[model samples]
Target: MTNLLRSIRTLPLLAFLIAIPALAAPTIIELSSEASRPAINDLVRATVSAEATGTTLGELSKQVNSLIAEALKTAKAFPRVKTQSGNTSTYPIYSKGGKIESWRIRSELSLESGDTAALSELLGKLQSSLGVSNLVLQPSPETRKKAENEAMLDAIAAFKARAKVIADAFGKPYRIKQLSVNTSGNVVQPLFRATAKAMMADAAPMPMEAGESQISATVSGQIELE
Candidate 1:
């Protein structure tokens, strides 16, 4: 009777050990699929700065600060545009003799808006007092998220289709052993550099062209053919 009981206990252990090798899938394959689409740019951004050089640091600081403050006040006239202070730096201007000749101070104001036309008009007005340093056009967060979700769905479908094709080619059934999905987009546009001196001189409503970005999603995984 003791031997019979020992045999019963060993039966379960043996079965578990036997199942381990079957769980280690031998025919595993890795595959990846990607989907991308053009997303329309809906946001416009501009960076404007005021710079002054004088013998006194305090005087340069006052001038640069005053110009940035005036630009912020003008930005308020356009309710749709958003304004924020960027960078402020004070540095010494060196003379040809390697002596500090004067002090220079510069401050930047960042502007963003969904209404491109209004923002463009504001930029022109601000350029009269401040120099236009940079301009950018890109999709807003909401728009980019929507595009990413759409691309993810397409990419996942493509991955599954490819897995099915591979399984069929091998004349075997398959199951996903591991899977991962990632998303990315061309969010960084090429830096637009404008001649600040010339822009300040003209101060016309800045011309802009809204471009598109390629938002993409990739699905990668390993599948086991049974």
Candidate 2:
């Protein structure tokens, strides 16, 4: 009986030792994946602001208001044309102090549409009337999603390629352990800032070219090494 018990205990110990090599194998390497794409739609937001000076707060206010109203009246068909009036106060126009400029009101307009051509035409029209203060273009949601997915797929492919290379280099087969990633997309907006607040201007319409804006997304993650 003593011998039999000793053999049983030794057998368990032997099995545990034999299992160690299979349980804690050192044959796998770590791999990672990352992807990124441009957020196109999210960034395509454009704000057109018009700036002008008035002799007094009331006078500037009236002019800015009038111009915005007139622009809207003409652009009845244009979509996403939103206008807002901003604060008015004395501001130095050209570093000339004590200009005692009466009122400095601003009219802001924003447009969000996929039709870049129409938007450009509308922007040109707006500039022709209201003097331009600033113009900003940003991406939209649709663009962002598309770009992000494309980037992610590319990144995953890249990671797989790299893993293949590593596995081949090691001269043995490997399996994936774990994979994870983090990603971020930035908004890249083009800014057209005018010295004066944008308003219906006297000069020729400012030509706007809303060209293809590159949106970018970046993804980073690790894959379990096998």
Candidate 3:
């Protein structure tokens, strides 16, 4: 009976010993690092829209379809350009007394190309029947990917440099406990409203200036000191 009581008394001490590592304090430091580079915009994207209104939805739909079909035919003539049909929306127009006066239907065509000259020429042709709704110049996917890879390398280097500085300041050796890296990029958006309006009045080729895009990468995580 005395031995059984002694064993029961030692149970709480044994449990405390097993939990010692879990109770230990964590020593970690959080840090962030980033890198960025410039990439030239090599792709052009444009959105052309055709809108029509009629007394009946059927008439409006027919008109819009004809306009889109013509645009698609013209776009297909250029083998290097990429074209896709976009959104089609139809809505009722209300009169002064809230009565339905007409139905308006709008359809969009999206165009993309690395050859700016060809895209410009196509845009000029389509503008006769469609209005320029949106235009953007950006880096191509391949270019963006290359830039991101480069930036990632730079960011990782910067992160290690910073981590070393931190370890030196802390006067201890450290190990990476956790880490994460991210990439981002920016595209230059030039005003195109005036340009589009000017193109509508003239048949001359659209003037294009592809600016630069900024690609960036960031590294963030925690390090534990030993």
Per lDDT, the best of the predicted structures is 1
TM-score of model number 3:
0.82
TM-score of each: 0.85, 0.63, 0.82
- Give the 10-residue window scoring lowest on summed lDDT in candidate 2: 216-225
User: How do the residues 57-171 of candidate 1 rate in per-residue lDDT, one tens digit apiece?
Assistant: 8878888889888988898999999898999988888999999999888898899999988998898888787777888788899999899999999999999999999999999
| Candidate 2 residue runs with Cα over 4 Å from true position | 1-44, 80-101, 134-139, 182-191, 195-206, 213-219, 224-226
Tell me the tens digit of each residue's lDDT in model 3 across 1-226: 9999999999999999999987776679999899988888999998988888889888888888998999899888888899998999998999999999998888888999999889989988887778887889999999999999999999989988988999999898888999999999887666765322333665556778888899999999998877
User: Could you give candidate 2's per-residue lDDT for residues 16-91 as a string of tens digits?
Assistant: 9999989877665555666554443322345555566756667776776777677777556676544444443346
lDDT of 1 at 84: 88
- Taking all chains together, the TM-score of candidate 2 against the true structure is 0.63
